[model samples]
Target: MATVYLDYNAGAPLRPEVAAAIAAAWAAPGNPSAVHGPGRAARARIEAARAEVAALVGADPAGLIFTSGGTEANAALLAGLAVPRLLLSAIEHPSLAVAAAARGGEEIAVGPDGVIDLADLDRRLAADPRPALVSVMLANNETGVIQPVAEAARLVHARGGWLHCDAAQAAGRIPVALDALAADFLTLSAHKMGGPPGIGALVLADPSRQLASLLLGGGQESGRRAGTENLPGIVGFGAASALVGDDLAPDGPTFRVGALRDRLEKLALARVPTARVIGAGAPRLGNTSCLALPGLAGATQVMALDLAGIAVSSGPACASGRQRSSRVLAAMGLPDTVAGSAIRVSLGWASTDQDVDRFVAAWGELAGRKGFTVSAPQAA
Candidate 1:
């Protein structure tokens, strides 16, 4: 049986070009920090990759700090801040939420649409002391709903707080300009964008801000992070960034995943009356749709799909234990049963119309049991 993967949100397969670049980079036997001829070649690859990444986000290459991945980037950036309060959206990934927890920060609530409430954010900022650091994601990993990061940034700046955006899910799917977004700090993951895993970056618009080191070792990342750089991974990440430009366009939808996704959802709802689309009314990414089939556990749906030769995930990819209601869905005001019923089908660069059809057929068989109600999941 042929297998179809519909979980791109968990991570994308590396592009062929990116894989070739990594192979070529790994063949080189010199550290980027060394000054010998071999070392110079390695350094050149790293610099070129930096340039490619800078171009993708319209950021200065000098402002980018390469790290192992998004988790490390968020931990390092948030752990270093000395603000009076660390305000993070409730819908953020575990990386930011964990960092905020470590710092004893407060969790800001989001609306039923899965977006941060600007008014609520303002209220929190007003009551807190000056120089707060606000952290929010550009697009949510679970729901694929785009956040109002630019407006959040503007409000943070007006109240003398620094804005940090975790663009892990948004970097390759949407247009992300560091200058245009006006965020002080931003984190991105390469694997989320068809690049190799283990290489990601953080961009700080204001380099003058004092950043403390999370690891203690020989100077790397300009002493902001320590340890030998993942040179091959970095090179692959740079090449992937260059590839992303080809996918973006000004008209229609730059990516076609959403159309196919809608077809799957439409069929599921038509066949399985109890089926519901989570965050259907909100704006979502072209590649993702989290659906809830009432009365069925998300884990059951995931297992059913995998057995059907279609791969999908329930909630965050990092989630552990038996699949239950997701914190994100619960925060959006869904009942435990509704949240637990959710399964995510995310398309990627390789996804095709045939894959969507396969998913629609498979979903109908698993979730179309009797007594199910097909309705949109309510947001908090």
Candidate 2:
């Protein structure tokens, strides 16, 4: 049977334009840092890609630092911060959580709606007079709930602190701007935005700000990050970023996907009256839905969907692609069963009405089943 892919948040499929761009970039035979003729050509291509990627987030091209992916961008930025206190939201991605924890970061509370509690943030910020760096993801990968980064930014700025937003899940799905959000640091992932994987970027609001190097012995990324850049991956990222403009308009691809997500949750709720939509109370990206049933384990749900030829994630597919219960739902004060049973169905650019219909049919059947035989989920 043919499979319907619904796990865009895990990693969107590579776009055709990006693939073509990568092919063209791969044929170029010089390093971006060399001083020769081919090197100048390579450097020009890299600069062009930088401008394209910067345009997507309304950032200065000089402020962007390309990395291996979003994980590295978050890690490098957090690692370099020399703050007296570091505050993290309860719902941060592992990259931010882990890196901030290494520097003695404290967790701030979030409401049951899966949004950051500005009061808790205020308390944390006020509790410490020293400068603090705050980490809040723009949109969550698992629940798709959007966070109040801009409001947090204002508060942090008032307290003479800086805010870092991991826009990995927000960037090509919803609108993001460095100035509009007033974030000191913002990160983006290529694969999450229909580009090639293994490449991403971090943007600084002020290009002249001194950033500590993630790597030493080279001047790449103006010495903030040192390594030979992934030329083709960067090219593909630029190509994908160029495609996002048409999708962000008033009634564009994102709006349609949001409708499909609503339809999905509606059908799931009608078919299984006990079903719960995690993070439904908050503003979320249009492409994602987190649904939970009372009795089923999320792994069981993922396997059932896999058997039915529908692809979804039990939670955010971690680095290992393992089916894991959601920390995001637990952070929202959900019951253990609700958190354990939640699965993420994320639509994207290629999603259609038929895809939603088939998913609802498959999901209803699985939820209605008397028993389940276990297997691995194909998080493809």
Candidate 3:
């Protein structure tokens, strides 16, 4: 049996070009911040990658701060905010909320459509006279619902607040223009966009803007982050971003993963009864679908698909090992039955039409079995 990977949102496989870049970087010897010859060579690679990442999101290379990954970028931003009140969209990734809560912040609500309620945000902003930071995700990790971040930025600024958009999921799949999005700060993860897992960037509208460093030492990342840079990971990420830049140009198919998702969804709906597609009525990433089957636990579906050599995710990968409803779906006002039954199918550059067809076929066969639901491994 052949294996099919449909969980790109969790992490995409590194492209051949990106892998080559990593290999080359690994062979080079030097600290990027050092002034020596080897250091200069490594520094050159870092700057080139910085430019590539900046190009992907329409940011200036000088303003891009490389971090260990998306989580650190988010933490740095949340920790740096000077707000008396910190407000985050309920649908944001756990990293955002976790960082905020660790610093004493509040969670704003989202509508059934998974979009932030602008009016509600306006009200909250009005209630707080102190400087506020409104953190909203550009694209939801689970549902792929794009937020009205530009408008939200306008609203936030009008209320004398700053806006931070977590653009981790949106970076490669959609065009991200910092000036157009009006986001004061945005986070990008290389792993989500076909880069190495250990590297990512925080694109700040102003590089000089002070943010508390999440890590300390060596004064790297322009003192915003401290540590010896992960040079190879950074190089691979740069290579990935450059590739995305080439593919993201006019009339490119960098995001054709969605087409495969639609095909699988159609097949699943046609073959399975009482199956409901979560976020069906909402605007989601083309490659993601959160489907629900009553009496069929998400873990059951995930494992069944895995057993058939198809890889799909359940609820959120971040919520691995737990059998709980998606907080994102719950925030969207979905009932437990719908939320708990949801399994995520996300495709990427590696997914093929046959993968989708196989998933549909496997789902049909499993759903038809007499003991499919009862035999599934319980969430550990």
Candidate 4:
């Protein structure tokens, strides 16, 4: 039995090019903040990586600030902004609303398609007169549903509010133009895009505009994020970003991966009697399929798939294998029966047709089994 990994949303496998870049960086050791000759070389390397990462999203290199990952970047943005209120989409990642009440933040509603309701956003913005910050993810990490970010940015700006778009899952899958999206702030994670883990960025559309520092002591990241940069991780991230730049075309690997996802979804729906998709009505990432089986528990499905050497997920990877309902689906108004039964199977650049075939065959076999859901593993 061959093992198939379909959980790209959790973290994509490190690309060989990224690994090579990281290895090359690791061979040399110098703090980017130091003033010696080695330090100057390190700084030059970091700057080159910065340009690649910035170019990936059509952002100015000066506007990009390197951070530990998406989580820290989001926390910094949320904490740094001096807004009197924060309004986030109901389907945003937990990082956005971790301290909703304490930070004077409230969730904007989303329709059943898992898409942000612009009317609701406008109403909420109009309902409040204070300076506000609105955070909406470009694409959901779980359902992979793309949000109306450009439209939402218009609404946010109409009321003098800044918009933050989390593009962690969207950057490599789709084209991300800072000006086209009209986002004031955006976030990206390298691990989600075939780079090494523990590296990501927070982009400011305005390079000259200053944000408060999360780490108080250093002049790193333009005094915004205070720490010596992770050179190897950043280099790996840049390599991954550059790779995405090459393949994000209609006739590239992205298109083939999308075909794999569609084939898997069509096969699952045809073979499984109770199969359903959570955001089938909405435009979603080409590589993700949030398939649901009405009577099966998501955890059980996850465990069953694992047994067949097929990797999938109940929802967000942050759930960390917990047997709980999905907040994303809940926000979309999905009932517990449907929400609890959904599993996410996300593909990537390295995925293949064989992987899709294996998944469909395994899933169909599981659907035909009796009492397969019982006595399943509790954790991924």
Candidate 5:
């Protein structure tokens, strides 16, 4: 059997267009900051790619700052915004969580469906009468549950607080309009959207808002982030961003992936009566499913599926190689046992019916060995 990769949320396979763009960028020479023919060419490439990435989220190109990855982008925003306090959703990615923690952040609870409790958020802001930054993810990377960012934004702005959204998982998988979301700062990762892993961006909804520079040399990224840009990665990011239009379209690849995801969930649930689909009641990304199988450890399922040529993840790929219960699920009020048994299967732009079929088959076989026989659903 061919290998089926269902770990798109971790890092999607690079698209051919993005690969070609990286190769083209590698062939070119010169620093983007240098004043010369080659340097001017490099600068142009970076700017063009920046525009493409900015367009993906309906952001102004002028406010986009390139960072090493989503981690750095999140850190930069948390630090640069210089908010004395931070209020973050409990289910934020580790990067945001760490950054927020460093700033003495307070955790806002999410409902059992994995959505932030807006009333709790409002209450938190009211309790803390300081100028705080509210950081909530556009979608939970683990459960794929979409957050009510626009509503959160209104709450934050009304309290004279800044709202920063981590849109890494939501950008290519759903409609992520930065202005429409009313986010003061937004973070994105290229790898999450089929681009190179080392590059990402922080988009400012209002370019006039001053963000302090984290790095202090060469004055790159409009003096917000220092260090020479990753030209090849940025070029690949632009290429990937250009391809996201189809994924965001109403009748697009994302919808097809969503159908496959739904099929997989339906079959899994029908086969294993004890299994639970996390975040099923909430609005979610089209291409994601978080499956929690009682009496089965997530790590064991991941390993078994891997042996069967199916690649799935117990949680965020970043948290891979470690044995730990999913904090995202725990935040949603799941018991430790259920959280520990949860695994995430995410589809993407290149996912197909065959890929979904293979995964379902492998999963069913594995479940059967554990004394649960999962029968495939009849084709409609």
Candidate 6:
């Protein structure tokens, strides 16, 4: 009865190296901003971590601002960027979506594959002559479908608009280059990549871009994000980023994990006639599978899986206590029932074949008990 954790998208388990780094950093006692000897030592540690993190995304170390987490980083960008109008994809994370909405930002629709509509973006940009800031996620949190961020950036730049990419879900699982994506701003979360949960970063492509400070104290993070840095968390984040090297390669850990995800989806679809994999047709992250069980509620399935000592989730873990229909699936045009019944099963670097097999067996038993026939679904 070993427990299998499959909800990496929520927050990956902390890596041993990251934990060790955190422990070491916690032993130091000096504010990074202080000019004293201990402070200089602390500042050096923070700068080293910054370099490690910046390298992961091909960003200039000086241009990266450490924030509390992905949410704060996103909030700072959405609020601080000097753009008259903001446009974001409908499938963006709640943090981005809520921040955009609060600023009276409009949403660009995503297609059934959960990919942003480029034509709609062009039209929207043309319809409005105002200087705009476009936010599009690099990969979807629920379905793991990768977006055409580089292409979107080209469009945004052509129209004199800046492109901001939320790469929280894509950073460690894939190769994310700020230059390759051509994003003006990019967001990264450490917790999503097996690092400490309290620290994340906002990467700026241009060091000269005007960024209004979100927090106005201490003048930390080059006065872009004010506040004392989370030393231990930043250390952990750096350790985790270093370990993610080449994991996004074809023969890397991520590719193997994706194979496991595909196997799980294939097994589920074969055992439960009504089960379908959402966003299967699109290019998705190797470690994520969004399974929709037509007649079963996602909450019910989540609880049942938990009872079996398996960890899975209905949607973003950020929405834990307020479970509802997945906005991501809905944006993909799934009906309320289908979207509500969808559960996301995400793998990680620590995932193995046994975890996948155990989940499949448990899910099959549950589906059988729910009166679902064991038959393969017809091809779409």
Per-candidate RMSD vs. true structure?
3.5, 3.8, 4.0, 3.8, 1.3, 2.3
Q: In candidate 2, which residue pairs get closer than 3 Å at backbone N, Cα or C atoms, i.e. clash?
A: none
The sequence of per-residue lDDT tens digits that candidate 6 reaches over residues 56-135 is 99889999999999999999987787789999999998998987788899999999999999999999999989879999
Tens-digit per-residue lDDT, 1-380, candidate 5: 67899999999999888999999999999999999999999999999999999999899999899998888888888767766778999999898887677767899999999999999999999987887899999988999999999999999999899999999999888888988899989999999989999999999988778888878877888878888899999999999999999876888888888888998887778767678999999999988999988778999999999999999999988788889899899999999889999999999878888888777777878888998756655452
Q: Write the per-residue lDDT of candidate 2 for residues 108-211, one digit (tens) a residue.
A: 99899999999999998998899888989999998999998999999999999999999999999889999899999999999998999999998998999887
- Name the runs in model 5 displaced over 4 angstroms: 376-380
lDDT for each residue of candidate 3 in 70-91, tens digit (9 for 90 to 100) = 8888877766656677899998
Better of 5 and 6 by lDDT: 6
| 4 against 5, candidate with superior TM-score | 5
In order, the Cα lDDT scores of the candidates are 0.84, 0.87, 0.83, 0.88, 0.89, 0.90
Residue 139 of model 1, lDDT score: 88
Which portions of model 1 show Cα errors greater than 4 Å? Answer: 250-254, 369-380
Show model 6 residue runs off by greater than 4 Å: 375-380
**How close to the true structure is residue 105 of candidate 6, measured as C-alpha lDDT?**
90
> What's the CA error at residue 285 for candidate 1, in Å?
0.9
The lowest-lDDT stretch of 10 consecutive residues in candidate 5 is: 371-380
Which has the greatest lDDT? Answer: 6
Ranking by lDDT: 6, 5, 4, 2, 1, 3
lDDT score for candidate 4 against the true structure: 0.88
- What is candidate 4's lDDT per residue for 1-380, written digit by digit as tens? 77899999999999999899999999997899989989998999999999999999889999999999999889888777778889999988877767565676788999999999999999999998886899999999889899999999998898998999999999899999999999999999999989999998999999987788888888998888887789999999999999986678879988888888888887777777467877989999999999988778989888999999999889887776578889889989999999999999999978987898888878877877843332221111
The local lDDT score (0 to 100) that residue 107 gets in candidate 3 is 84
> Distance (Å) between predicted and true CA of 371, model 3?
7.7
Shift in Å, residue 237, candidate 5: 0.8
Query: What is the Cα-based lDDT of residue 46 in candidate 6?
Result: 95
